[model samples]
Target chain A: MTDSFSGQEKSNAWSIKRRLTILYVVSAFGILLISTVFLYWVLTTRLAKEDGQFLAAKINLLREILAEAPNNKEVLQEEVEWETAPFRLAKYYARILDSRGRVLIETGKMDTVAPSYIFPRPARLGQTPSHAAMRKSTNGHSLLVMTALARVGDSRGQTRILQLALDISHEDELISDYRSRLLLVLLAGILLSAGVGVFVAGRGLKPIEKITRTVQHISAHQLHRRLGQSDWPLELNELAGAFDGMLDRLEDSFNRLTQFSADLAHELRTPINNLIGETEVALSRERVVEDYREVLESSLEEYSRLSHVIESLLFLARAESSEARIEKKLFDPRKEIEDVIEFYEAMAEERGVTVTYRKASAAAGSGFVNADPTFFRQALSNLISNALRYTRQGGKIEIGVEWGTDGGLNISVADNGMGIEPEHLGRIFDRFYRADSSRSENKPGSGLGLAIVKSIMQLHHGSASVKSEPGKGTKVTLSFPD
Target chain B: MRILIVEDESKAAAYLKKGLSENGFVVDTSSEGDGGLALMEKNEYALVILDVMLPGRDGWDILSEIRRRGIATPVLFLTAKDSVQDRVKGLDLGADDYLVKPFAFSELLARVRTVLRRGPVRQPDILNIADLEIDLLRHRAARQGTKLDLTPKEFSLLALLARRCGEVVSRALIADQVWGMNFDSDTNVVDVAVRRLRRKVDDPFEKKLIQTVRGVGYMIEND
Candidate 1:
């Protein structure tokens, strides 16, 4: 993977950004080296030209001086001899040669320097005291020889020329040393930039590595673990906040699911215990026909209770899964409630609890509503049963159904019993939540009744609410949308 | 009255023995089908309570073997596998009664009395235990020519115990037998009724017939 990422052919071995930066510095140093070499070439060439010019002028003066003498050749030779003396000038080396390109003046020093030299040829040389630079070789010594032709004593006599040469080996050595130092500086700069690039890349990617490790250690059960958003860099802080928020939601849902399952098991235990107890009792004894019949009856009752609890649990589960299909049909809510209340009338009468119903005058004609009759009846029955259980023997219980303002339906059950306290009123619909006395002492019921009612109401696209005072009474209202 | 217990578990069988012997019934036990059948073939028992899930030979097999051999001892099947089909099947297999497991001892005693009684038409109208005699058909109780006016609950409670005179009966069994399914465990119905019955049946007498076993149950024993 690293090879693939780094192997873009067009990219320089160094990154484009780094190459550009280094290139700027290295190219400037290269230009500086080239300029220094050019400056040295120009300066040395000009100095050599000036030295040749000065020697030519000196040769003209000597020619005039020697021509004025009584013996020209001997005088010229004597003058050259004096000028070429070793103590004359250390930087200058001069020689005089005849038109035949031979040594004309016998300067003892010049004799060794230019025993055989290529003075400018007579015809090829310029006419009016011209100058030419040439190379000389004598007795295994090499020199940069400059020669100039000139006239003597205002007349062209003997056609003598002046020659000068200088050794430039020391200047060449100094320029070579400077070039080596520049090369070393450029190589060091490249190595240092590569080290800086690596450090910067590692520092920039550190937070990304930290985020990866933190996420890997997190598990569903450990929702309390957080990314500690404050510790994250500004670039990643938003992501950490969102992660913590999602964990909060997940924790809440997990807690609710566990509690719901526990409540379901707790509710089912009552019927299961009863069933096991009664069946065990019946099986452990020998009985005649009459006694067997009584045991069978109790056993059957327990079986029915078990089936009821199981079916409710199944319905609740299906509702949660969104698989509970309501068998929609038109049903008379008022008549249905009335019939249920009438069915339970005998029990209420036996207990001296009065059962009543108050149906709206228009309800008879407008009682039809689309709902699952089975679930509807179950919801209504649970409400009535809860009412009957709570109310004292002489208390009154009433059921009502009417049409609401938005063409919706409303149903309610009111009981003049020991009403629920304010604190418990809101939580009554939560599964397995029961008010203190009615749940613990007076009567026992699977506290899933209200939860089942709420689920059924949800299936019907309705809402359920409760209104009550501690001692006065309680009214449960259910409303369905049209 | 003679009774037979067919159970696989020895501890349960011993407990049954202790209880039935204390209640005054002549109790015989068998841990297997053939042994129970051999006992049944040699003696005529008033009742036989059999357990369904047994090793070697099951309760149904023993019941079938007894019936096939023409021993018409009244049989009750007590089993832990208490499904509806098991109940129907036991009844069809000629079991006189069926009870599930973990039953109260008093219920077992009640059922034993019920099964031990002679056929409906030939049942003895009067049941007697020592000096105490009960006219069950008339619902009357008397001891040594003294008439006892017992309430309905008291009469039924005493009659059930008197019928199984020497057996130890646990309170759970008594509660199940006396109140049946109508009473909840939270109520003191069984103890209250037993107290009332004890007053009428044993309190006034010098020789106490009804004895209480600590942490166990009540028993009708000789002084």
Candidate 2:
């Protein structure tokens, strides 16, 4: 059973660790992905704005030159000089269109490029100097184009549309490079987080592993070992404590079992040794018939003793195993006690012990109880016999039946005899346990009478308890359910 | 009468065989189940004394085989398993009687006799114990030609006690036999009845026939 349980626990531990690692990786990757997308968007938007601004400034310079020139040809000449400036490193193009939509001045680079719809045209002649920026492909190169409607030389009626373009392929390439690098970094971050997650999960489960190891070291033989609860975390400390408690119970039962077996062997050995020694001695000689008869009779006594032990042991075993069925029926408790008292009357008389029965005034008329009469009698008889065994000659043994304080039936056998010590009262019901060990030598019992009584009470779903004080008296109570 | 003993423990088997043989029985012993079964199949025995735990095959299986073959031979189960369920199971399997181990040899003999008496072959109607004679068919008992007045229960109890003469019969057994009671009554009804029976069976006679075995029960034996 433990093997299967541990196997299940191992799988559970593995799954927990795996799940923790997966959870960590998934959340980390999600955050990283969102932040990367946001950063890329911000950088690209800024770059596009800067490009638009640069194109607008270049367009302004062209507008100024066009306004200053006397004719369209001189305007072209000034444009060429402006384009030749050392600061203007990027390839540039420009075109000027009148209000009639006729191109008046065009730069040398503009003639080579196609006339594409890079930006929207102004609705009217001047409409607050409308400006727009767009992208166009020229000669297999991507360019940013900015168009504006400017009033030349401050003439309110005169207006010209200025179109400026700048090659921005380098900026596009830089943005793409940053995007790929961001993706690589995101992958690395996921891997690193997964590794750290696994490490942390393993550390978190270290205490459980330690507990399992400690428990595994404790075999059936070494049940005293415990998982040190002080070293464990709070949750696992509870688990360790539970485990230690279970071990305590196991050790207690194991010790009891070991002791029971040893006691059983000892009890059997005495009678067997007597039988064997007497028989062997008798067989060693050619005895007369009467001598043989005497030997047989002596051996029969030993056999009878052995038989009693076996019978009591079997009864206890059956009771413990739940094989002894108690046929519960409604019967008179007082009548039952009276019957037991009557049964022991002959023996009590022979032993010179006075036995009496008492019924409480509160329970005098009420007699019915749901219990197994035979088992109740058996329990009562056992107690009465014990009382007879311990009570001095001419002493009194009172058997009483009454309603218990808690409302159930209570039958108590109190003997004013050689009482048991207070310490021995608790364990008197243990199998093969003797209250007065010295007095046991003279008592002809299997030392199982009280144990059998206890078992009988248990079979009836009741409880048996004893109270005793030295030099006073002993009282045993069998409390039954209502 | 012939009997077959199937037991694993050699010492127990030997003692059983010796005791039964001394009691005028032709006893055969087997220590294994298969051999015991084979002996049962071949021989006509008065009864079979079987132990529950045996090598080669268990007592339950052997008994089942015997019954399955349509043989109604009586079987008395002798076992160390004294639980009520074991006894019920043995009886359910067609065993005539069940005796727990570490039992008194006298008890075993009495049970064996009871089982054998249940067979189809009828025992003699007359039972003799020294000078006392019990006529079962006529329901009469006499001591030295003097007829003794006895009730039906007293006669049956005396007959049972006389059959297993010189052996102690517990009050529980007497209650079971005479009163047909399976559960003890907590009262000394059996002892009281026996005391009444003893007055009639022994008080008038010079030589007492019924004797009390203290702490046990009663025995009808001549001194």
Candidate 3:
């Protein structure tokens, strides 16, 4: 519908500018025609009525003079001749017709009589005058003729009709002049509207063209390119701002992913080298049975390390690429937390770290919420591992699960250990980033525990935050939205 | 003989230690560039295996440093970077050879031996085990002084086995030494080559020197 109305295709024939211009021209021309027709009808009818009255009065005067001098034909002719100049100056043609409708007295150079004209009978005797008005031509000239009957001096038997006409050539020329002026005004309006329409169309399309140019210049390698804020409208500024923010996130994420892959390969190279190198060395040596056993045992340990690294790296890869499918199900938060803490009790016992778990009574309407059990367990395990690694030999670790006032569940893992510094807290979840580089050797980690934990929490649509000081204990909290 | 290993990782260092120690070469390692240059300047090493990336500097820098210091130690780069540009760059920087990581240790050992063979040791190019003899210089093989007709691949396989007598040479090592690049061939090229060489070198003999250890590769040993 819009396309048909706008004539979208044929710009040369009906552009938006031309269409708007045409509308203005057509409406103005129609209005001018109606007004000119109404004005011309009103003015021409009034002038004709007035001319008819003046002619009627003149006819009455000539009748009175003719009645006073009953047989004076030459004097009547002289009186009529004196009136002829005034009538002619007023563009009127007067002629006297006898009672039989024959032309008796003719004025000016009209030598032959014109054809008779007709009119409908009037309703009243004198209120609506019964007259015949028509266009007639005699010889080479044309004239309008109006005829009215008049009684000679109260004698109904003797009636005379006077015919009058006023030439309309000057009125026709005046109407033509008015029409030409109306056409000029209509043309001016059309041209002005057309120019305005083109200007508006250009202004409206400018921002759209800028968006196109910005998008065209972007590529995979150049994801950093963003639509910068410039001289744009309000909505366009907001759109460009949102686009730049999204690009900032994408570039940061892609760079981190690439760096992580490289680091994974670099980290795994060490273990694979140990496995292959150890096996080759043992097989190449001419050793006794006992020596062979020793070589086999050590090689098995190296293989296990390789397998462990590969498993952890695979988990990290799945998390990084978002390939890990999360199955959300309703599970009791209290039971899940207690079970996890109990499972880690044996490992904690070895280091004399007492692990205690406490679950607060489920809050109102908070018996359970939706969560991925596997990811939840994985995230909890990482927190436990970190707590145990940093805790003192006889320190206590608290694992508590509770329902928050808001529609969420909070699980906190707090331990009495050397807490992290404010500076390191932000980067603790980075791949291969350890709180203390020296502690890495002691704990013997792949350095992907916190990174994997962060990813798992993200998958579960939850968040993990940590609070720590230089010397006090640390608290790690996981919040799952209800 | 002296051998140099330029590896960035410590675990790989330990792995190479046991293998090269048993191969009769006193192996020394550098985990970075400065250490590797320091070791090369202080010692007269026969072979050097370097990695591309290190802490202080990279292997290419060590290679250039070694050359700048006029140390003509044969360096074989062992790294995970396997692009052509890396190879060309390493060779251009005075590296003797390049081997990508995730490599079979025996292949590494073989390259080390090959590089060392052309070094100062310059041992006799002829290898003899029991009655079987391989003349590396002439590229010929025979059993009990009887010259045998061997194909180009068979002669090389027989020669490699004869050189590493009494020790198990892995199939991956054999493939690497022969094919150069690590390509998986479906056919049992090693076994077929060994079988064909047995016909040429042991068929007309009274004693069989080419013996196969059940699950292991073929061995040329003394009776």
Task: Show the lowest summed lDDT stretch of 10 residues, model 1 chain A.
Answer: A121-130
The count of backbone overlaps in candidate 2 is 0
Q: Find the 10 residues in a row with the least total lDDT in model 3 chain B.
A: B179-188
- Looking at candidate 3 chain A, the ten consecutive residues that score lowest on lDDT are A119-128
lDDT (Cα, tens digit) per residue for candidate 1, span B69-119: 888778989987645567888888899998766565666876777666546
Which pairs clash (backbone N, Cα, C closer than 3 Å) in model 3?
none
lDDT of 3 by residue, A322-433 (tens): 3467788888766666655644554576678988876656452255757887667667767887788788889999887777556777788999888998998987887877
Q: What lDDT tens digits, residue by residue, belong to model 1 across residues A251-314?
A: 8667766776776676667666766787688778887887767766566545544544555565
What lDDT tens digits, residue by residue, belong to model 2 across residues B114-137?
A: 777664875678988878999988
Ranking by DockQ: 2, 1, 3
lDDT of 1 at A34: 76
Q: CA shift at A88, candidate 1, in angstroms?
A: 62
Q: A375, model 3: CA deviation in Å?
A: 2.7
- Residue A47, candidate 1: Cα error in Å is 54
For candidate 2, the per-residue lDDT at A408 reads: 71
Model 1: CA > 4 A from native: A1-220, A223-253, A264-303, A359-368, A402-407, A437-444, B1-223
Task: Name the lDDT value of residue A162 in candidate 1.
Answer: 59
Question: How many collisions per candidate?
Answer: 11, 0, 0
Residue A280's lDDT in candidate 2: 94
Across B1-223, the per-residue lDDT of candidate 3 in tens digits comes to 8877878789998789778899787888777788878888788887888888888777777788888888887888887754556778988998878777656565577667666666487556888777777888898887778888876667777877777776667654565455331222111345655666677788888788778743334667775
